[model samples]
Target: MAKVSILYPIFRNQQDVLRDLKTIHNQTEKDVDLLVLDQRSGKNKDSKSRVLQLFPKVNWIEKQFKNIAEMMNFGFSRAASDLLIYMPPNIGLKPNLVQAYSDAFQSSGMPGMIFADYAEVLPDGKIEEKRLRDYDGDITERGNFGYVKGYSLKAAKAVGYYDEQFNRAEEYDFRLKLSEHHDLIRVPDVRYDVFISPEKASEKMSVGASKLFYPGEGK
Candidate 1:
């Protein structure tokens, strides 16, 4: 089987989905499985059809989820590989992302989760580097670390997957639990790019700020 499985959630942005898919399809690593979870509503039928037309070989699933955490839990349960990459919509992967993650998994003695530095694509078309802090098991760390992240399927399942009750900060809750049993490794290299719209960026900031006050909940 593949060394890593990429779980991608598709939303309303067809252009962003297509762009990220192209990058995924062009990856230098060949032994990577991609599972696309399309969460678009019935009104987005045309967009869904276009995606299928362009990438007919992709493992596409049409399922509506009540929350992002539920969608993530479903994706992790279906991933074929033990190493899972949770790649949200509007994120761009580097050519060596899979290979780098695979290498980090092996070299780090198969940590529970892996995260790397990333670049941000500004609206003005400029790229800004975002170097993430090392995982120090700090409860006060920002919740919006980045969009693309790596997780150990076994570790996630061990922690009972993500909590569906949280529509926001689900990942934060999941990571806090995962870190309890396994190591959270940070790769120093930049492996992906986050393309955040202004509205989404604002939402992320709010989530990050809220996480500071409620760090004791997930534990």
Candidate 2:
């Protein structure tokens, strides 16, 4: 059995989907299973077909939905691994990231999650520091940690999967909930190059800004 399951919920970005899939497949640790959830349905048939051709080994789950959270919840429901990583389509994995996560999981047991620092690359190729804002604020005083960045897969069932109500900051809220039970360690050795696409950033901002108005509705 794979030690970790990477749940990638795909929408309409066919151009970069293959690259994302390839990045996960090329991870240093071979014990990770890539679960690609196709939420594009009929409109994404061409994209799905292309993805299947590139990675026939990947476990593909097709769903017709406009709600991103609903599709993610469905994907989590189908995951078979104890550890689950909820990630965006634009993020690329750095070497040893999976191993680092696995090692952290073994060391801490239940409620332990391993996250790492990341570089935010702009369209002009300028790199900026990326900070992970969760719960109250940056938990850097927690330990052996650099600045926090990127998503993580750890103790899925124990931490409780992403809330379907939050299509935007689901990972943030989920991480906050996980922190309640598990201690988050930001490993400096493992890092991911998270590209901030203008389109995606805009969409996320819109969802995040509106989430405040909705309150617990996002939970």
Candidate 3:
């Protein structure tokens, strides 16, 4: 069985979906699965056909829900692997991310959550690996872990998955809950690449300004 399952909750972004899919398929860790939870149903279905053609191996699951948190919760509940990484569409992954995450789990004695630093990719092609504030509730409470990701099924079930009540900042609340029991470990390596887009009204929906967009960030 694959050790890692990357859950991608996609709404709509065809411009780079195919490219991103290829980036993930090429990860160094062969024992990994990518599950795309497609929420772009009916009139909003834009990139479905293209994605299927470019990446037939991807496990595509379709559902209609405007709430991002609920979509992520569904993905979490359905992940076949014990460790799942909740990510969004159009982001790039480090070739060694899956292997790194698996190793982190083993090294930490299989902790509930494992996260690493990330290099933010700007439109201008500048990549910066900003230092992350290692797992601290007070800091986490004010701002979700910037680029960290991943959680174990055992630990997730104990605290309950992302709260549907919060489409925004759902991760912040979820991480805070898990912090009560499990310790959020940090890996210094940069594992994920996040590209910032123009501001949209949806950005405001985050539970608060201090929310994690990636499930990996909640912790």
Compared with the true structure, what per-residue lDDT tens digits does model 2 show for residues 1-219?
A: 667777777766545777767766775366777788776666666666887897776788776765656665666666666566665555444434444455555555655453444433333433333433322222222222323233334444555666657644455445444444444322221222222233443444456633322222212
lDDT of predicted model 3: 0.56
Per-residue lDDT of model 1, residues 74-101, tens digit only: 8888888888887765544445555555
Off by over 4 Å in 1: 42-56, 117-146, 167-170, 183-219
Give the TM-score ranking, best first.
1, 3, 2
The lDDT values for all models are 0.60, 0.52, 0.56
| Number of backbone-clashing residue pairs for each candidate, in the order shown | 0, 1, 6
- Ranking of all predicted structures according to lDDT, beginning with the best and ending with the worst: 1, 3, 2
